[model samples]
Structure formats: C-alpha cells, structure tokens
Target: MRKMPLRELAERAGASPSFVSQLERGRTSASIGMLRRIAGALGLTVADLFTEENEVGHRVLPRAHRPELPTGPGARKYLVSQRPLRNVEVYVGEFDPGASTGDEPYAHGDSQEIFVVLGGRVTLWLGDQDEARSYELAAGDSIEYRTSVPHRVANAAEEPAEVMWIIAPPTPD
Candidate 1:
C-alpha cells in the first residue's frame, strides 16, 4: 500500500500541517466537513477510508503494531483492532487520576458502543445535558449504549484506570 506524506495530504486537503499530523497520529478528531474534504482529496469517500478491503489470508497484528489514540492530556487509547478497520473496532483506554474525555460530552456516529472497566474506577456520563445519567464503574463492570447521544468518561479516583471500548460498524466521523 502507498502512503501520502503528511505535508502533501495537508496541502491537498487544505488543512494546516499540524492539524493533519494530529489527525494522522490519532491525537485529535475531525469534523464531518473536514473528514469529507480529506477523503475527497485522497480520491475516497469517508467510509472508504475506514472500511477494510477484502483479503484472502488471515494476518496477525502484534501489540506493538496497535495504533495509539491520545484522547487528552492525561488519557490515551490504543486501537487494538487491525487496520483498515473491520466490522468492529476495539480500543483500550488508560486514564490517569482526574483525567477525562473532556468537560463537555461529545457524540460520535450512530454506532453501538460498549464500555468495560478493566481496572480501577471511572465514571461515565451519557445523554444530553438536560437528561444526562451518570454511572460509576469499577473493574469488571461494563455498560452498553448507542453512540448517537453525547457521553463523557472520567477517572475521578486517585488511581489510574483502564477500560475497554468496543464499537460496531465503525463510524467515519
């Protein structure tokens, strides 16, 4: 497979070089409009960029090969699934004390999501601000919900927390 240089992609997409770099590194999220522009520049649709192509053989993706997605200053997630993404995507999240997705809740595409607390304690907030519900999860606890509504996750404990996230039919934006 061929890869486009970050600078070249940024130029083609009419985005800042730094923004493109951040996107490539999975350190940031892009708006639908920006995603469309980037995909168009690459001669692909937003879905085309995410859906995996059919291959004849099976492959193994070692731990080192997993992509890291830094959500914020003190929180990070690792994409544990193979690329390009398949029907479902898995992520392992690590959050330091006081770390969170953000102060405000955010929503993704209409995919179904499951969050499992692997270790430590964390809190999950879901739905719109007016009717938001909060859940405190400990190790081994899990919750399932749709990604259409806004949500936020945070580690309010003094210790670090680990969680697993599973999403089906990965969304483009």
Candidate 2:
C-alpha cells in the first residue's frame, strides 16, 4: 500500500500533525473511533491498523488476542473476525461519556451495516445531516441501514457505551 503523507492524513482525519506524529512514535494513542476516522480517510478500516499481512484461515479469535485501539479521547475499538480479503467485517466500539464516531456522517458503496448496542446507550443519526432522524439505542438494541445513506454514531448517555458493528462486503475500501 502507498503510504499517505502524515500531514495530509492529519488534515484528512481532523487531527493535528503533532498528535499523529506522537501516535506513530508510540508516544500517544488516539481513541478507536478517532483511529477509525483516520483509517477511513485513508480508504482503510480501523482494523487495517492492526491487521496481519500473512495469509490465514477462519479461526476463532479470542478476546485477549484481538487487536484493539483507541478511537478518541474516551473511546476504544476492537476488530473481530477480521479476514483481510473476505466480504464481511466485525467491529466493537466502546465509548466513554462524550466519545463519538465523528462530527460528520459518511456514505459508501452498496452495503449495509448492523449496529448492536451491547451496553449503555448510543445514538444513531441516519440520512442527511440536516434532516437526519435520530435513533437512540440502549443495551440489547439493534438497527441496520444501508451504507449508501449517510449516518453517524455517538454516545447517548453519561456512562460508557459498547457497540458492535457488522459490515457487509468487507469494511471500507
């Protein structure tokens, strides 16, 4: 893969270059949601950050063995059942207090994503931002929408929130 310029990536991810440099040098770690946005800007899934390049088969991925990263100040993320060349991808997102997916919504190709709230509460903004319908979800709640439609995710409560996302046709590009 061609490497993206750090400054360019920082701009695209809405992060400061100094912060991105620190992250690259292991001096700091961005939340999983933040990392996801950076990856998305680079045409990759957050899972891509921790993905192994070796060819492998479908095997059980123990929680302890799963790769994790921070998304923002108070968020974390995990890649579950990651098959680099497969057609499906699974992700786990943990948000603390004010943590969120991002400030803007994004759309992609022909695909749908399933969002399941496993703990705490979260809000989903579906459709155009101006006229988006807000869907508040609590533990055990689930919702699905097409990737072609713009959408966003955010924590809806003061407590921490955990959610799982199943993406079809694999994750982003």
Q: Estimate each model's TM-score.
A: 0.68, 0.62
For residues 84-155, write the lDDT of model 2, one tens digit per residue.
Answer: 535577889899988887788877754778989999999999998899999999999999988888988889
User: Candidate 1 residues 53-120, lDDT tens each?
Assistant: 65626878787777797588899889887655546778898999999988889897678999999999
lDDT of model 2 at position 29: 89
Top-lDDT structure, candidate number = 1
Superposition error at 82 for model 2 (Å) = 2.0
Q: Count the backbone clashes (under 3 Å) in each candidate.
A: 0, 8
Candidate 2 lDDT: 0.80
